[model samples]
Target: MEYVEHRMNDEAVKAAASAGLVSPLNILLLSIILYTGYSTFFAKTSYPQLPKPPPPVVFKTYNPHTLLPFNGENGAPIFFAVRGVVFDVTPGRNFYGPGGPYANFAGRDATRGLACGSFDESMLTKDLDGPLDTLADLGPDEMDALRGWEERFTEKYNIIGKFVSMKDFEELGKKE
Candidate 1:
């Protein structure tokens, strides 16, 4: 039992067990890994931008409902359109209810335009909150709005196909 060698080769050193304490080599390796992650993630200074949206296109229309439009008085009509999609552009819609208050512009002719403004039951509120609620909560014009909404939202009501247009939406609303 008298064969005590001294120096270990590089291969043997690499195979040696790690010490119970931290080492400079380990710290350097960890720092390198952390820095790589930081540079890849947090240091992202630029990225490929998304395509710019198309320019706005005006397509105005008339609204002759009892409820006033945006920034307009009650019973006054409003109109404005841009980017192929149109909006009431009328301010203070507190007077018009969803279906009749403001005029939404959506087309299905040949362009298959996007779904424009629409009335939904979810927008109703209990009790009156002034003009907004008064118009929104009333049921006097329920028949007209319901009919118009039905025709526009009943074109597409299946999962097997995609929605063709706003005109093709489901008319599964409650029956009168």
Candidate 2:
């Protein structure tokens, strides 16, 4: 009778262990389902917003003297004149700023240099008050090259202003 009672007690213990294991598994599955439902039906998802771009720059007129300061010096914007147009080349500061390969053209007329494909200082006009380069001596090939450069400039940089002689600038100021 003692042996029979011991066997019965062992069977009861095994049954309890199995029931405990199944209860935990069922509770885990129920918790997962509840969490899934809560997230799908009630939880709000959010995403970060992007910043707006800056407004367009207003166009201004500049002459050789007035355009001289925008040479990427002292934190100034880089500017260069091409075919009587002043372009804000600040975006290309690495190429047109001080210590740059094309720095000689900054704050000066770059037409002759660009047309001749020369980055020499001689290509730049020395006199600020002097008349603009006529570019009359440029051959057809040079003219075409200059046009190509102008188109590239137009596509890359902002046309911030017009390049004019000091005389013309003065006349414009007087008229205004």
Candidate 3:
């Protein structure tokens, strides 16, 4: 009789486990589901990295007289200069075209204006004729701002060429 009773208890425990009632396997399944839910719904994830691009192919140098013609005139591509770097801003013609807010900046190297956060035409200059000391007026904060603009332009646009002074143009013309 004692042996029969022990066997009956064993059978009852096995039946409870098979019925998915309080059992080790059931507890483990619940734990897995909870963990999966927590990870999927609550865990923080980092941003994915962007792919690297190839080096840009730079075109010949450009002067303000040459760069100005691409100002969306008669379906021409719009262009702009920043800190001696020229960008084809045709893609954003509505924002940089004639009569646009930044229209004054389209044909000029407005580095000083950008650095100082001034839209004054006086700050814009295409003639980088003077010595490097011309930029001595910029403070550290202004320089930082200028660097930020250049970085943003590099990331966003295709750099075509650099701005050239009349003196440099003359020298290159003589060479060619």
Candidate 4:
């Protein structure tokens, strides 16, 4: 009788396995394990995307008087002009600031001064009017020096705008 009962119990367990039957607790546990494994290995974490930068500001023409405010004094930015191009030299504030070595050149075009190697106040104006024809007297060496300064400015600073010429002003008048 004992042997028969033991054989019947083994048969019952085998029948349950062959029929694909399992307890509700076992099914729930297996589902939880599968979900945890998938989340750890296959799930990706989400992150916030960064915004795009704004466009750059551009100035078509810059007048000498308009360029005066950025002289590295009284909380203004330092700017200088070489040739016909305007450059922002705020990075060299110690040299271009007020009372500095090149302070007189802060608000003006210093093309002639740079060419002649003179920091004279008379050589620092942006006026291209009559009786002020200084650049015309410059020799080859002076012109080369001016070119070198222009190249240095182009390499070092940002070219904000170009100097507005008398011809350009006249053309603007014509357009209107």
- Top candidate on TM-score is 2
Residue-wise C-alpha lDDT for candidate 3, range 1-176, written one tens digit per residue: 99999999999988976887667788999999999999899999788988897556658688767776777767777777786788877677777787777777776676787889888778876354532225788899999999998998888878889887767777889999
- Which regions of candidate 3 fall more than 4 Å away from where they truly are? 1-58, 126-133
Across 1-176, the per-residue lDDT of candidate 1 in tens digits comes to 22333334544565564552367888889999999999988995777899997455443332212111332335443332222122332332342323444323211111111222343433422222222122333354554554454444344211111212122222312221
- Which candidate gets the maximum lDDT versus the true structure? 2
Which regions of candidate 2 fall more than 4 Å away from where they truly are? 1-46
Worst 10 residues of 1 by lDDT: 106-115
How far does residue 114 in candidate 1 sit from its true spot (Å)? 33
How well does model 3 score by local distance difference test? 0.77
lDDT of each: 0.34, 0.92, 0.77, 0.79
Error of 1 at 39 (Å): 8.3
Task: Name the lDDT value of residue 43 in candidate 1.
Answer: 93
- TM-score on alpha carbons, each prediction: 0.20, 0.73, 0.61, 0.61
Task: Give the per-residue lDDT digits (tens) of candidate 2, residues 1-176.
Answer: 99999999999999998898789778999999999999999999787988888568778888899998888898798999999999989989999999999998888889999999999889999998988899999999999999999999999988988999988999999999
By TM-score, rank the candidates, best first: 2, 4, 3, 1
Candidate 3 structure, TM-score to reference? 0.61
**Model 2, residue 90: what's the lDDT?**
91
By lDDT, the better pick of 1 and 3 is: 3
